[model samples]
Target: MTTLLRNCRPMGGTAADLLIEGEVITAIGAGLPAPEGATLLDGQGMLALPAFVEGHTHLDKSRWGMGWWVNEVGPRLIDRIDTERATRRGGFDPATQSARLAREFLARGTTRIRSFADVDTEIGTAHSDALVALREALRGTMDIQVVAFPQSGLLVRPGTLELLDQALRNGADIVGGLDPSGIDRDPKGHLDAVFGLSEKHGKPLDIHLHEPGELGAFALELTIERTLALGMQGQVVLSHAFCLGDVARAPALYAALAEAGIAVATTAPPSRAVPSVRAMRAAGGRIFAGNDGIRDTWTPYNMPDMLQRAMLVGLKNEFRRDDEIAWALATVTDWAAEGCGFAAYGLAVGARADLVLVEAETVAEAVVATPPRRLVLSHGRVVARDGVLAS
Candidate 1:
């Protein structure tokens, strides 16, 4: 299939025509002639950008398609975890909810996502099974990487390690772990179990490190040590690494993480401590953003919009200037795609034809205003328009 997108400003630059053949962009230039018998669509001079990438999220836990869920869980992380487990045990269709959320993400201009599926003794690999099916179902339109996440803690919950192993063997593409020192109280044991699974299955690791201060730093050190010892450089990511917020203690850690090729993901929660985006970038550490959980039992705040998430990141990081805001936008677009390992994702020729056109004059304006996506294309096919999924 050949399609030409005409009169679009690539990253708010000069208006140009983008030629897409099959699923890759073939050419981009002003007044490019469309191939004979190819479909031509008017871009109306909208700002063009690579489709958003969700670096980290929980696909199996979203209650988006359901009615408004009242969130009354305690502030503590354990409290939220217990409440979520009870809610899941009470019964909810993971496939249905995940599909709904995935479609919503696509409609919002997100073409790729890395989602964590809960794996515990109670639920086992049920979440992973559902997510795996969803991943296959949305194979062409949306790319999803499933992580066998032990949300409830591995060592603390007996048999969870085996369950994670099973999840990876079944279809999960990544291995996940939660706070090791904070939750399991044994950082070494927790890291060993997860790193062992990653080595065994030849998968990557995306661990959630919510441990604060020195504890979080210690866990991060252990993670980096394992990454180096196992030659897993660039194969590991640390999510919600709040410890990186400590400017005083972060420089050395950031240097080490950069050397180890380890990446970081942050939701940029307003009330929580977050890593310095500029500092990490300067230190050569790759950092991205995600909308963690949306309308789940854990929290009633948050939406599936990566653009909105980028705006939040900007606000949280105090990004005032246009360049800084544009950097924040990259967290969800270029940086997020790179961090999540989305191949051939960009607005350049030979890249995948996954793009979104928004009604904005510049990237910074788009990030600040977050205007509705006027058109979205995935794999050279129009998939959405005006914030709605096209049939």
Candidate 2:
């Protein structure tokens, strides 16, 4: 397929014409001539950007658009975990919900996602199955990466390590682990099992850490040790790493993360303080954002909109200047892509023709105003428009 997008601003830069041949962006320039029998789409001054990439999300736990399920306020993380396990014991079909959320994200200009599927004895593989089904169902329209996530713990929860191994063997793209120090109580053993599975299957790892203060910092040190020991630099990601902000050694931690090429995913948890994006960028570490779980049993908050998430990061981080806000926007776009190691990511020529058209004059204005996704394309094919799914 050949398509021409005329007068569109690339990365909030100068307006130009973009020519996409098949799945590759062929040419980009002003006054470029269209090929024979090409489909021409008027940009109408839309700012073109790479489709949002979700680094961390839980598609299996999502209850968006369902009747309200108020989360029980908990003083501890275990409280919420127990509540969620009980609430989701009798498995609900996630196929419908996953499909709906995928449509919502696509309509909002997110074409790629890395979602963690809860794989424990309690939930079994139903959640993983649902997301895998959704992946097959939405093939070509979305790029879905599934992580075999142990929601409870690696060592604390019996049979979880084996379940994670099975999940990785059964179509999951990556391996995931929970809090090493806090929940599992044995950081060494937990990481050994997690890293063992990762090495066994040659898959990457994404660990969830909610441990606070010094404990969190210690857990991160252990994570860094395992990452460096195993030589899994770019292969390891730490999600919800709120401790780097709690300690005075954030600069050193950020420097190590940059040197090791480890990534961080922050959902902008209102209660947790996250490290400065500018500082992390200066240190050369990748930082990204995601919605996590929206309207699940664990929490009643979550939106399938990455743009809204970016705005929230800006607002919660107290960003005032346009450049600061733009930095937040990159967390959901380019930075997110880089964190997830998305190779075919960009609005440049010769890149994948996966992009979104928003009704904004500049990237900063788009970040501040967050205009609706006017048009979204995946691999040169229009998939959604005006908050509606076309394909």
Best by TM-score: 1
Candidate with top lDDT is 1
TM-score of predicted model 1? 0.99
Model 2 residue-pair collision total:
0
Tell me which residue pairs clash in candidate 1: none
Please estimate how well model 2 matches the true structure, expressed as its whole-model Cα lDDT.
0.86
lDDT of 2 by residue, 1-391 (tens): 8999899999788889999999889899999998999999999878998888887888777887778876665777888788778877665667787887888888999989999998888777767777887888778778898888988777998898888877777788888988888899998898889889999999999989888788988888888888898899999999988898789988999998888878999888787688677778889888989888888977778788888889888887788898898888889988898898887788887888999999888777888788999989997999888888885
Query: Taking the candidates one at a time, how many backbone clashes does each contain?
Result: 0, 0
lDDT of 1 by residue, 1-391 (tens): 9999999999999999999999999999999998998999999999999999999899899999789988788889899999998887778988899999999999999999999999999988999999999999889999999999999989998999999999988999999989999999999999998999999999999999988889999999999999999999989999999999954779999999999999999999998788878888999999999999988998888888999999999999999999999989999999998888889989999999999999999999999999999999999999999988997
lDDT of 1: 0.93
Candidate 2 residue pairs that clash: none
Pick out the ten consecutive residues of candidate 2 with the lowest summed lDDT.
87-96
Scored against the true structure, residue 91 in model 2 reaches a CA lDDT of: 57
Candidate lDDT scores, in order, read 0.93, 0.86
